[model samples]
Target: MTTYTAINLIARPTGGPIGPDLFEVVQKELPSVGEGQFLVKQNHMSLDPAMFGWMSPDTESYIPPVELGDVMRSSGIGEVVDSKHPDFQVGDRVMGMMGWTEYRLTNGVGLNKVTAPLPDEAILSVFALPGLTATQGLYSIGKPKKGETLVVSGAAGSVGSIVGQLAKADGLTVIGVVGSDEKADWIINELGFDGAVNYKSENLAEQLAELTPRGIDVYFENTGGPIQHHVFERMNAHGRIAVCGLIADYPKQTPDLAPNWIPIIKKRLTIQGFTMPDHFGEIPALLEKLTPYVMQGKIKHRAHVLNGLESAMTGLNLFFTGQNKGKLIVKI
Candidate 1:
C-alpha cells in the first residue's frame, strides 16, 4: 500500500461522550525509511484513562496535551517491517508511543524492541503502562505492609487489579471497590481479593465498613467517586493513600468537593498523587520489582479490545460508563 490511514485531534472534549466529531480521519502517503530509522506496522494500540488528560487543553498537566491536527498520542506493539537502523531489524517486535496510525516511520529513539514471547494483549495489559503504573503507585506511595487491610477503587480495572493482586501476594488483606457485581465477583473469586464492595449498590458506607472492619491501611485511588469519602472515613492512623486516576471526575465541568481535611491531621495520614511519565527513567527498576510477581502467577489481567483504529473514537466512552471490564485496547 502506498498510503496509510491516520486520525488527528480536531477538537477537545466538552464534558460529554467522545465521538468522531473530535477527530479527523485522513490518508497520508507512506514515508521513506531513512538511514538510522525504521518503519513499524502497528498492530495493536492501548486506550487509557490518561487519554482524557491528553485530549484536554490543560497546559500544566504531567504531559503535554495532544496538539490539534496532530496524530493522537498512544502506545502500541508493532513489527519492524523495514529498517535502515542497525539495532532494529526486520520482523523485530517493538512497543512505544507510535500515535494513531497504521504505520510509523522514525529513528529508534523512543521505541523499544519487544523480546518477551507474550501476546500483544498481555504485553499492553501488564508490562506496558498498566503494570508499571500499578507498581509505581502501590509501592512508592501506598507503602503497604503485610497483614494490613487495603482497599482499592476501580478494583477491576487494568491498573487497579494488578495493584490488588500484588498487595495480596505480599500478605495484605485486600478489598476491592467496583462498579458492578460481576466485577466484584471476578476480583474476589478469580483474582483472590479478600472482599469486594460494589459502589453502585445501596448503603455504600455500610458495605465498605463491613468489608474493612480493621480500617484501611492502604488505599489505591483509581476512580474517585462517592466511594472516596467512604474510604477516607475508614482510613487508619498513619494510613497511606496513593492517588492514581480520578476517572469519575474526568467528564464533568465541576467535580465533587473532597472530604474535610480535619481527619487528615487527626490520623496523620500520608496522601500522594503520581503520574508515570515523571518516573520513566526508573522503568528498569520498576520492571525488576514487578516481573517476579508475574512469573510466579500472581499478577492477573483482562483486556477489553476494540476492532479497527476508528473504534477508538467511541471506545473511550466505555471508561466513563464503567462498561469496560479490563484494559481497553484497539486491535488495529
Candidate 2:
C-alpha cells in the first residue's frame, strides 16, 4: 500500500494574499493502473494567474471553478510509471490537466504526449499554455503588422514575454509594461523589446509617450493597471487589443473603473477577450506559427521554480507581488 500527497481547494480567496487557509493537504492511497489506464508521476506543474479564476466560485468564468475538496485544477507534465493503455508506454512523457497531485490515474483522454527534446520547464514556459496563449491572442486578435508599435502589459511574464518576442520578430516596435526596473531591463535587453515601462515608476504617462511616439497600433494587455489607461489614451485608429489577464484588479474588493468607451469608438479599436480552453482545437496551428520563432531563437524564456508541492499554496502570491522573474512552475 503506497500513499501519495495531493492538495485540494477548501475555500475561495476572500481578499489579500493567497495562503494555506484555502487548501488542505492530504495523503491518498495510490491507485492501480487498470486496463486502458496509465498512472503518471507528475514531475512539474505550472502556476498561472488563471488558477486564481479557477479557484474562484465564479461559474461564469471561461472554465469551471475548482470545486471545493477537489484537487486544485492545474496543468502539469509527468512520466507514465505504470501503464495498461496500448497507446501509452511506461516511460512516455505526458502533460495536461493533472491537477495539484503527485500522481494521477487516467485513460489519456485530455493528456498529450510530450515528444520535444526540451526540458519540462522549457516545454511549460514556451510550448505549453504561455506560448499557446501568446500565439493565439497575438495572431488572431492583434493582427500585428511590421513597423507597427505594440505594447504588452506584464511583459516579463511567461505569456507577455512570448508575445513581445513574437511581435518583435515580426518587426513590430514592441514595448513591454512591467512592474520593476529589473523586469523592464530584461525585456528590453534580453527579450529584445524595443522599449519597456515600469508600471511602478513615476511619470508612467511620460515614459509611455516617449517610447510610443507613433501611438500604439497593437496592445497585448495582461495587467490592467494605470498603464492601461495610458495605453488606451494613445491607441491608433483601427488598433487591436487582446485582453488577456487583469492581475491588477484581481485582489481588489472593488476593481478600478475601466477606461471610457469613447476612446474605443473614437479609436475604432478591436477589443477582444479570450481564453485558451475555447481555442484548444487550434493548438496545432498556433504551435506551427510559434515554433519557428522558437527554433530561430526569436523566443527566449526563464522559469522561476519553487520546490515541493505544498509551496504552491503560497507560490501564487508571487504573481501579485511581481516577484517571479519568469514562468512560475512547481518542481514536484
lDDT of 1 by residue, 3-98 (tens): 999999999999989999999999999998989999999999999999999999999999999999999999999999999999999999999899
Which pairs clash in model 1? none
Q: What is the TM-score of each candidate against the true structure?
A: 0.99, 0.99
- What residue runs in model 2 are displaced by over 4 Å at the alpha carbon? none
lDDT computed for candidate 2: 0.95
The local lDDT score (0 to 100) that residue 23 gets in candidate 1 is 99
* Prediction 1 TM-score vs. true: 0.99
* lDDT, residue 294, model 1: 98
lDDT of 2 by residue, 1-332 (tens): 99999999999998789999999999999999889999999999999999989988899988889899999999999999999999999999999999999999999988999999999999999999999999999999999999999999999999999999999999999999999999988998999998889999899999999999999999999989898999999999999999999998898888899999998888899999999999999988988999998999999999999999999999999999999999999999
Regions of candidate 1 where Cα sits further than 4 Å from its true position: none
Give all candidates' CA lDDT scores. 0.95, 0.95
